[model samples]
Every structure is written in C-alpha cells, then in structure tokens.
Target: MVAIEFPLPRTTVPPKTGPILPDVLRSEWDKLRTVRSTYWTLFAAAATMIGLSAILCGIYVAQYAHLSAKDRALFDPASFSLTGSFLAQLAIGVLGVLVITSEYGSGMIRSTFAAVPQRLTVLAAKAAVFAAVTLVVTTAASLAAFSVGQMILSSKGIGVGLGAPGVLRTVIGTGLYLAVLGLLALSLGTIIRKTAGAIAAVFGLVLVLPTIAGLLPGSLSSVQKFLPSNAGLALVTGSHAGKTVPSLAPWIGFGVFCLYAVAALAVAGVILVRRDA
Candidate 1:
C-alpha cells in the first residue's frame, strides 16, 4: 500500500527591518534620563553657573574701587557672568564621561550593543541626546546668569546690554562652548571606556594643558590661543577694548575648538567599531 505523502511544510523568512534612528535616539534618551547621575550632574552645573556668576559679580561690584587700573581695565562684565563656566565645565565634563564609561563599568554596554548592533549609531545617539540636553540647560542657565549679573552690575552703572557689541555673542557662545565641551568629554569616554581615567584625561586636557602652555616662552606662549579651552573661551570672551584680547576671531576660534571635538569623535567611532564592547 502506498502511504499518502503530505506536502513539505513551507518555509518563510522574517521580514527585514529598516534603520530606526528615532528608536535608537529614544533608547539613548531613556537610558540617560533613567540614571540618577544625570539629574545630580545637571543640577550641579546649573547651580554653579548661576550661583558663581552672581557671587563673582558681587565681588567685582564691591571691589570696583579697590581694583588696580590694570585689573579694572581688563574686567569684562559679560565674561564675569560666564565665569561660572570654568567650574561648570568640570561638572559637565565629568558627567559626560560618566554617561558612557558607567555603561562600560557595569557591563551594560554589551547589552546596548546587542540591542543596537551599529556601535557608531549608538555613539551618535548618545552624543546627540546629551548635546541637546546640555545645550538647552546650559543656554538657559547662561542667559539667566548674564541677566542677573548685568542687573547687579547695573547697580554700579557698569552693566552692558545684551545688544552691546560682543555681549550677545559672549552670552550665547558660552552655552555653545559648554555643549561642545560635553561632546568632547563624551568622545573621550567612548575612547577610554573607563570612568576615572576618562575624567582625568578630559580634565587634564581642559585645565592643566592651558596652565602648562602658559609657562612657555612669550614667543611660544601664543600656542595657548590654540588650546581647546582657550579657543573655546574665545567664543564667550571675544576681544573687548579693555577685556579679553582674543588672538583669533570668535567664530574662528570656535571653529578650531570644534575641530578638536570632531577629530576625537571620528577616532572614537573608528576604535569603537574595531574593538569588542
């Protein structure tokens, strides 16, 4: 007897999925917001930016008459308001490094990569989310600080208008500078993959490098203008008759500073893909 033969079961392949950048961005954003460090770091940055600016402006107001002519001549009310950025940078930079390094430290990076196999995409999402958040928060804080400082200085008739030459640029450029600084730190974190080491490297580059460069001979000291912090600061403290004397144009210096961050990110993208998570 011939047994009835059943037809072979038909095989089917799963439908292919297209790239979903929004999903990646959403995931990165969720990861960033879920962590407590994000709130604490951002709070610290905001408080420092506003608090230090107010306090510093108060000191300047009180000491206006006592300051030597040379010191008085170089005082910039706009830059004074943004002075908090120096301290805020540490907070922003450290948090930026922690954003990625913490994942590596906790072995969560592997899971992230498993969920999103395109490593550079993951990096880009992180950078984009962090940069956007930083830009908003820092810009608001910068504007507030500037307004408050200007109001305080107005008490002494030394306040400048937002419309004043270089004033608006300094105020807005400060926020942009901080955003780029955060991106640079994030790139370094991606490359180093360790929290402490990455923080140290970033801080060293930002803080120590300028100090070291300052010690060079007068002829070579011009090199300091090209340093990342110096160049970035140029955007926020452009040349004023009696204040900061920027060697490069504000936009030019900012462009140079951007190059450093871009170069670091490009290198990080290459290393991230070539190595295991």
Candidate 2:
C-alpha cells in the first residue's frame, strides 16, 4: 500500500471575545428597572428629599421672618436646616445599601454573575446605573426644594431666586452632593454585603464623623473641616471665609465627596473581582 502524505490543513486561532462594557451596562440598566426593590427605594429617596426639604424650608422661613435685611444678606437660611436632609440622607443611604445587598439576599447575585461572568463588569454596571439614577432624582429634589422653599420664603417676605448670586449654584450643588454620597454608600454596601454594617458605616461617614469633629476643641476644628461632610458641603456655598471655617474651598469640598466615592468603589471593585459572590 502506498501511503500518500496528505497536506495538513492550517488550523485557525479563535478570535478573542472580550467582555463588552456597553452591553453589560444595558443589561444592568434593565436589571435595575425590573427590580421592584430598586424602584421602591428610589421612590423613597425622591419623596423624602423633596417632601421633607419643603417642610423644613417652611419651618425655618417662618422662624426667620423677623430677620433684618442685613441678617438675610449674611445668611443662607434657605440652605440651612435642610435639617431634613440629615434624615433624608438616611433614606438615600438605605436605598443605596439595598441596591446591592438585596441581590445577595435573593441569591440573584449568582444569576447576575453567571450572565456577566466578568465580576468587575457587574460592579461597574451597578455603580453606573445607581449613580446616574441618584443624580437625576437628587437634582429634581434639590430644584423642587429650592422652588417650594423659595415660594414659602416669599410668603414670608424672603425673596431668593436662582439668580441670587450663589442661590442657583447652591441649589444644584447640594443635589450633586447627595447623589455622590449615595454612590459612596452603594460602594460600601457592595463590599460589606451586610445591610446593617453598610448602613452604620455610611451613617458614620456622613453624619457621625462630622459631628465628632465639630464638637472637638478649637485646636481640632481647623483640621476637621477637611472631613467629607464638612468640606464636601462647601460646594453648596458661595464662600467659606468666615472665622473658624474650613480651609477647603467649595470645589475642593466637593472633591472630598468624590474621593470618598472613588475610594469606596475601588475597594469594593477589588473585592468583587477577587471574591466569590
């Protein structure tokens, strides 16, 4: 038998099918919308932020009705005692915590991981969707607060509008601040996985730490202004030149909030990719 050597056909190398970020983003967005818990939380955030903001504004406006022109000029009473936001932030934080923890609670995280096996992709997707939603809702609430608050204040002969120098900026900036803070909470929850822990952590970061510093002796007050809540709040103000005020400028204050978000998300991203869901 003559054994003829057949020519070997060339083998083809498979093309690299890397993960698509945009597709993952679309999938995540769909997940967010269909998820009932997410909707509820978002609704809660919007309602609390807008509703309580208006109420608080009304309360303070009524109290400040006796203010002289100079007192009004020197004060941003309209922004103060958003005192409601202190409580409203708790709602926003809870929503942020649930956004991730609920998935783990329902064991849906396994399905999410199976579909989008690239773990970091899932984390990134969640962050983007949650952050975007927060920004929109917060901006709306802030604007509503400004409008309704202004109307109530106007009823008390306190007229402040978007054109009132820093009024518009403050209105918008406070919204951005809350939204960023929400993302930070979400990032914290993603890493911790325990609702209580994340909630406590966020509260400590947002409220407790600032309070602690403010209560410190005069020696510490100067340095405490650099904390997330204190420094970050300046973004909503036109100036911070008052005595004993933060050395942090408005933009810099907002930057501190960004740093908190970035650091928390980075840690959570690392854990999500390296650890099992």
Among the numbered candidates, top TM-score falls to: 1
Distance from true position, residue 175, model 1, in Å?
Answer: 0.7
lDDT of model 2, residue 58: 73
Q: Give the Cα error of residue 27 in candidate 1, in Å.
A: 0.5
- The Cα error of candidate 1 at residue 18, in Å, is 2.9
TM-score of each: 0.91, 0.84
- Relative to the unseen true structure, what is the C-alpha lDDT of residue 276 in candidate 2, on a scale of 0 to 100? 83
RMSD of 1: 6.6
- Model 2 lDDT tens row, 23-135: 88988788778878766776776677667767876776776858676666665644652435556667778878877888887898899888778888788888888778878
List candidate 1 stretches off by more than 4 Å. Answer: 1-16, 68-73, 242-246
Which pairs clash inside model 2?
A: none
